[model samples]
Target: MAEVSNKQVIFKDYISGFPTDADMYITTSTISLKVPEGSKAVLVKNLYLSCDPYMRPRMTYTTDSYVDSFKPGSVIEGYGVAKVLDSGHPNFSKGDLVWGFTSWEEYSLITSTEMLIKIPTTDVPLSYYTGILGMPGLTAYAGFYEICTPKKGEYVYVSAASGAVGQLVGQFAKLLGCYVVGSAGSKEKVDLLKNKFGFDEAFNYKEETDLVACLKRYFPEGIDIYFDNVGGKMLDAVLLNMRVHGRIAACGMISQYNLDKLEGVCNLINIIIKQVRMQGFVITSYYHLYPKYLEMVLPHIKEGKIVYVEDTVEGLESAPQALIGLFSGRNVGKQVVVVARE
Candidate 1:
């Protein structure tokens, strides 16, 4: 087997507070093109790397969390779209396109095939696997439809509404005939929520002095469902404004990921008083529903019934900054790194 240079994003070390590009370094190492004999691993060429908020938590050293922390001096792991070049696994073969958990490298020997999904069709952009067709997509699908149990004409709110998961949740709410409102950090994102994603109303949370008053103004009748992504003060506010028996889908808390001391929800008592059903979910648990999700979302995508936006940068070298940008609200949409076009 011939060897090729593999460019990688290596995690430097566990750290406190916001992670910078310094946390990850780009390096090149040689790798063989074939999977070793008697090995059941799949050798893949990464096409697109997903920059997700959840990946932030994994950057720290923590056994307290269910997700394992990224090891120092190793290629950071993330969900990406890939092309199999060689395989010792029976389920996969050479030239098979896949999307799932993979390392932040140009080439990877994927030993675990349990989470990997063969890309069903190439008609959609392969990068969709990194966003709309991958983890974030499933997160939104499971969180909104399954967790929130939204009904027609319900009042819905989504924080970080222009983000990968949040954008989809708001649109899904609208599709169900719900009145959707979303909050974002910038006017550009807020405009995207209202004008692009079809949210009934959108606001820049940065401009709001009081999130509780903000939600109350958006939903005078009180929120029926809250798709919370940036939890912190926003979540506390939503807790206070939730209607009786309302549902809350706790997706990702980008606001709390970098903090040493996690923020507490002060209006938790309102959960009991209002009888709100607030549930946090992990997307891995809902992978079984993926086939059903694809069936529903694909048509909506093709028909333009549902739209997705992505902020893409070229090459593996750009990945670290792209991932770091999520916390600062620097990317306009789903941040993706293009490793290989094919």
Candidate 2:
């Protein structure tokens, strides 16, 4: 077996509040190209890495999250597109392309192969395996259809609308003939939501002082479906503007992830008064729906009925900053870091 240089992003330490590039460091190491004998590990050369909001919680010393925290002085693990180099696992082979839980490095020896899935085809951009064709795509599909239970001509509202899951949710609602509105952090993101994703309307959430009143203005008849990506005041505001028997899919709470103490929502009473349903879901629970989602989305993508946007940065060296940018809304769309061209 041959050994090769592997460049990696190391988590320097557990963090509190917002994460910066300083929280991680770049380093080089060596790894054998072959998987060890009698092990079920798969060795891969990483091609692309995903930057997602859920990763923020893993940076803390301890978190009440579905995933484990990133270890200090160790590699940051995430979903990535990779080519199999060697494998002791029967399911994978040399040269096979896959996407799943991989380290932020040029190469990885992954033992937890449960999340790993072979890339079905390369007809679409391989980078898409880190976004639209991967986790975020399934998240939007399951959250909207299964959780929200949307209907035609219903009023839909999405928060953090230009981010990975939100963008797809807005588009999915529109395709179902629902009247969709979304809220993003910047004017540029707002424009992309309305023009690129085909939402009926989009607004910049940062400019709104009274979020409750702002929601009322956009959704006069009240929102029937709410995709809550950013929690805190925005969720409280939306609760007050939800129609009777409304459904809310709480995919994430990006706004509270960085805070030491989370903000409170003062509208719990509204849930009872409006008779609404709100559910918080982890995408891992919905991975079983991938094949069905792919069949439904692929034709729409090929025909230009569905579109995806990526804000890409190059190289393993850029991974830290690219990930940190997701919290500050520094990225325009789905944030992807290109580790290697192949």
Candidate 3:
């Protein structure tokens, strides 16, 4: 078989503070399209790549982290959807669509199929696997239902509400009959939260002079469940406004991820005062519930009861800019890099 040119986005070095497009560079390398015999690996043609905030942590070199940091001068890896070109694995075959951890390249040879999930429904856009039907969707489902344990009619708040994970959380809250509010960085995102995602209320945090006062205005009755996405001042404010026995699902701390010095929250007293249950979670821990999540969400999607938005940029060349844009809140919804049509 003839070798194919593989274009990839490679991490240049360990990043500090916010990452720039310079932190990653695109390069081309040649690879054989076929998986070697007895390799037990699947070769896939990447279709869509997900730009997630969690990837920022992988850019930094850390001694203690749940996930390993990306190697310098290696392809940056993240969640993506692909079509199997060749496979030595029993579960995957040619033309099968799958989503999981894959490199930032036109093609990837995925050896570890343990986490890879074959796409069962192609009725929805295949790109949805990178967000709603994949990692972000699972994160929202596990964090909200398993951790938050929300009650109907309860007040819920989601930070970074227009983001991949936050948008889904707000929609799920609405579906569960909870009164939901979301906070985003810009007016456009705030508008999306209310008009598009069905949040009860949405606000631009950048416009608020005092976050504490802002939370009070939105939740006069106090927040019964808080899906904390952007930590820092927003978390401190939410602490002061949580109702008795409120639950907090600590998801991503996007605001603090790129900072050289992590921001500290001074509201532990509120946790004790309200007897709140606060928990931090990584989505991989809840993979066992993925089947249940699909069963519940797939129908809602097919019925038009749930909606998803995506910000797509064409080609692997746009991956760096798309990844960097997350820090500035440039994306309106889930940021996706379309690598190939098939």
lDDT of 1 by residue, 1-342 (tens): 779999999999998899998899999999998999999999999999999999889988889876899999999999999999999999999999999999999899999899899999888888999999999999999999999998999999999999999999999999999999999999899889989999999999999998889888999999999999999999999998999999998888999999999998888999999999989899889999999999999999999999999999999999999999999999999999999998
Model 2 CA deviation exceeding 4 Å by range? none
lDDT of 2 by residue, 1-342 (tens): 768999999999989999987899999999998889999999999999999999999998665678999999999999999999999999999999999999999999999999999999888889888888899999999999999999999999999999999999999999999999999999999999989999999999999989999999999999999999999999999999999999999999999999999999999898999999999999999999999998998888889999999999999999999998999999999999999989
Clashing pairs in 3: none
Model 1 lDDT, residue 266, Cα: 86
lDDT of 3: 0.94
Q: Once superposed on the true structure, which residue ranges of model 1 sit more than 4 Å away at CA? A: none
Sorting all predicted structures by lDDT, with the top scorer first, yields 3, 2, 1
Q: In candidate 1, list every pair of residues with a backbone clash.
A: none
Q: How many clashing pairs in candidate 3? A: 0
The TM-score measured for candidate 3 stands at 0.99
Clash total of candidate 1? 0
